[model samples]
Target chain A: MATVKWPHFFHFSAPHSVVNTPAHRPDTRRSKSYGRSCVEPPSLFWQTPGHLTTLGHRIPTSRRAAKSHNITTKVDPEQVALLIKNEWKLSHVTPLYRFRHTQLKLYSKHLAAFIIAEKQQGVAVEVGVEAGFKVTFSAVLGIAETKEDAETVFIQVHSKPLFSADTPKAVWRGWLTCVNGDPEYLRSLPPDFVSLPLFCSSGPEYLTALVKSWFERTFDCSFGSLYLNSTMLNWLAALWTGCHPTSNIRYLKLAWNMPSQPPLDIAYTVNPQDAWELWNSIHTEDSTDDRINIEEVQLFMNGLEIHFFRHFKIYLSAGTLTKVSTALGSAHHDGKIKIGSSDYITTLLTLLTECALMKTPV
Target chain B: MDEQARAILQRVIRKIPNKKLQTALRAWDHLSSEQLESLDYAQPKWLFLENLISRCEENRLSLKDVTKLEMAYYIDNPSKGTWHAYQLFQAEGDAVSVNFTQFREQLKAHLKDVVRHVSVRTKKLEDGAVWIRIAWGDNFSKPNHLKPTYVVHYLQTSYVFVLNLMSKHKPFLYQALLLSTRHVSIKEAQLSSRSLTAMRDLLMRQYQQVFPTNQERTLKERNAPPSHPSIEKEHAECAERRHQMACEAFGDGVLPKLETAVYKLETKYRGNSNNTLNDKDELFRGVVMFSSSNLLESFRHCVSAGMAEGPVTPLLSSITQKGRNSFVITDKVPGAASQTPAHKA
Candidate 1:
């Protein structure tokens, strides 16, 4: 049996962007206040000016700004297929202390046994040997941008449900991976730790929580809930809208929270061509095809808001942008996401990684 | 009582609710204690005011003294107006040394020095909160009592809450706050609540907060998670963890009520696109507000619940992690404008 592996930090020096609009921020004194202890052995990494700076709209790194590049061939098609089908809930994991990839098989056996033991409470279930549920852990390679990035690990849970003769159906899917994490921050951690901060899961509520708890016990790490705010949804909408000319992003749909007595939810669905046109018009001066700057995204959003106001006598901007969707992907402010296409999966992953890293208590 | 009798106390007396009339009068401290004891508050509201106005006329109180009555009412019932919090940054040396009385003196002197046409009244609430009421005017006009701004601050904390402050007077008020609190600058905390108490409690984390520990939870609490064989949720430990995380991020039990969290964006749009607002120091000036009866509680529910696809993201978890509901996103990398990863959305 093959053992699970972790993501590699390939492009360790590569800088990443942060998420959210203007959310309230506390000072650095509360750094990693969520986790039990963020005590990393003092190293040369202390020289870099670090604090909550990495948590917000931080200092951008590359000499050439972040532009979307085609990473389709490098990533596994099967992995992309699994991601694009379902919406994902995101959680940020602290550095996994003493999380040995070499012992993944052992961990899998333990988790499977744990599930069985948990399912039928108070029963002395036989450990190992595939009980009622089966848990498999596998490495997903080629997704990491830098060597400092831990290679991705994918986990699946399958159940027979008394199938006896029927094939056991897959019940849960989740992965732990980080792309374009701050190299300085990753390096600063104690060598025993692997920083795969981003954890995405699709499964039953109890199962997801159980898996998370098991990881916490084994790895000495805590998971945090991260919701994508409206600013992020707008960013996603524009990013997908820009991909319209390259790949057909069937439609641009957005949801908002109205400033009403009983908070109202409003959704706007725009034709792909119209959104693309508005997007192109906003970026007429840039002439660049690959780069979709935040300013352009804002302007595109503003155009839609203006149009919406003209019709309904409501300033859509006055309402918070709660969710944004296209044929490629849809992200909710509540931290739910659907990756409809694999073309922009890398971009999506990269964005999520920054978010996860930002939540890292260290 | 005719207008003649009521005029002695100023028209603002009617603005005070009939229920709080006694407290307001007592706080005003204008009339003699013996006269106050003699007044019959249970009588018809107008008759009560008539007897009070006759006493005020005998005392020869001025219109300025009448505004004191209003300030007293506001100071006692702070929840009557909306309060916004501002953070005092770069506070140096012995910031918390000043007591409420000392702070009042410092503030009044500082405002008087900065601008002549201003009246500053300071009162310390029983709860250790220092309330400052300021009526402002330019060099030409006197301090306007009709639209005064009230500020509340606790000596130990860096946050200062204010109510009914106009934009034009923010700088003056900020300067007075800096000098009085010994802080370098004052900026909006971006968190506002319907009442002053709720905002303080939320900021101070004075409620039941959940945290993860090595010890196991009670069997009863663990079993609280809904159980069904189909979803295989028989594991109560997992559900407990979600609840713990949610409670850790946002306090459980009766949570503090915050009406709104407003984010004022001065962040550079770093999409690397042709939007005119990009680069050259142009910021995407925008505002986003999240409002609810209990914003923190609602946020906790969203984070705790499982999404159809997966679960909550880090962005959602950041509110509690950062410990602030208000933020100003700026381009930290001033020169390297093109750095984009993770932030594409």
Candidate 2:
């Protein structure tokens, strides 16, 4: 049924609980023991369900907020600019089977052909720059924090309508990445799979669906929307507000929505320095790791909510923290994100990945 | 009829609409068919009640018989109040069972032995739901039908759905349930719904639950879309695996309808020190709740449509596996709190 070498179809034959790292165990060093997975391999995919087990899901117990950095100097500035500009719709992709970063150019041709073919039933359309929709798949290099981490794959679709300009302009852009992905989970894979857990697309739903379908067919992976809830939005807000000292956040802007009889929306803006001062007042860092706890983050948000309540006579926490934006970038609770700057991209993706992992079935 | 019994009967009959009187009486099946035919159900509610009380008086009905009619109404309207589910844990490997008669005797004996003036009545529905109505009284008062707790449990399953239970009587009720069912202890299962039957159907696994199977999924060649021969699916294996995983995590077809899943986090605030919640002596408590018109359906779509990555996380899967939606996360492991009444996940 597939163009890949394997004829027989394989499903999640991997045990839900692949390895017991004790990484999430409170008070343990939060390092993924990469060597352990190599020593004790997950029961092979070809193995029976009887072999499947649960050591418990690999979710982190604690995490630190994103610190400011200059990612453009380390990565391609063009890629950084492209990433920071578009408000990408986020989804989590299952591990891709036999996806090789070295062969993205070939993948590009195949995907473009597949998309064109799907769009026009049996029409003979030669897929390339001349084609109405030209797809380009490139390796966004230097995002992988470990050897096990696969190079991020960036995809762009250029559209040139029948009577439009001669030059084909980019109509859509997306990327699949795993920056500082759970090393244990990446290592646990049988080596044929690429664990790119985060998928972000900026395009029309129609074209995005086609592209996703192509990726699903070609790579044999699945994608699910990753909705960033209000808690996550609050996390983003506090984290970005913390970055104001290093890189001016301009103004900390927050939007909230509560389901009242008439429905209410609150858009609160605070001076970057004021938000930063409030964050510092509540965010006490006694440890050398310079980490911020979930409690402190919640407290910082509470301080804002209380302040808002004191002035406006309405509790903001009653509604959702729908949107949080600053000089760094903006993120919506519905899972759309504009990077604004590449500095904290890893931090955002890492948090998203962790949040994604928390959805494991009971 | 006894004065108390007459008042209880009057109130019970009044609660039922004029139209449902016949069906409710038939369900009660206490009054003779001839006597039922003799009365006028279409008369004013007060007249109807007075008429019914005279008939009961002529029959010399006891308090117990009057309670039967009240039970009948409650049994008909199982949707009277909100029901919370609790799972019973047995100490040993072998699960224990009790027949209807034995359970009734044991429950009545346990409650009567504990409280002097307590009134406990048991009735079994056709679908094996044992409905127990208990009226409580303090040292000075007689058992009051005005305030009664309804306990519903399927004889075979471990769940007990209680409606309007007083916290003061919880340990006593738990004791009775444990003795009646031969289970050791009971803990809140944290699942609640307005419909008692919904809770029962969910915990009892009345609906189908999908599991991973070795059967070949033969995709009909006719269903394939016409394609330009140049493009082909390189990784059909993954698509198949994800579909199967989705089905396994969330059952195929119409998913179970659960409106909410709440988690009360009482775990220690293990964080960077100097945080107010990081008190070593006291645990930090927070509630994370997910609500939708149909929560399980939403989660199923989240899994099937690829909003949630596979293999499904234990937290979401715990909904079906634990047959529960509410969880209390404590000092134990993060996933452990959602497992069962007693066993940690």
Instruction: Report the C-alpha lDDT of model 2 over B1-345, residue by residue, as the tens digit.
Output: 777888888888888999989899888887899989998989999999998888888888888887788788878887777788898887434345478989899999998888778999888878788889899876778888878899988886788999889888888899988888888888888788777766776788877667455323433232264354343453354555555666677676555556666655454544444544345455433444555656666555544444445777666677888788776555655666533332333
Worst 10 residues of 2 chain A by lDDT: A27-36
Give all candidates' CA lDDT scores: 0.67, 0.70
In Å, candidate 1's interface RMSD is 11.0
Residue B33 miss distance in model 2 (angstroms): 79
True contacts kept of 1: 0.02
Kindly list the per-residue Cα lDDT of model 1 for residues A71-174, writing each as its tens digit.
Answer: 56887778767767786888989878677777788887888878777787976756654557888887777788888888888888888665378887889998
Worst 10 residues of 1 chain B by lDDT: B306-315
Model 2 bad stretches (over 4 Å): A1-8, A11-61, A122-130, A161-165, A359-362, B1-345
Q: How many residue-pair clashes does candidate 2 contain?
A: 14
| Model 1 alpha-carbon drift over 4 Å, by segment | A1-53, A57-72, A123-130, A161-163, A284-290, B1-345
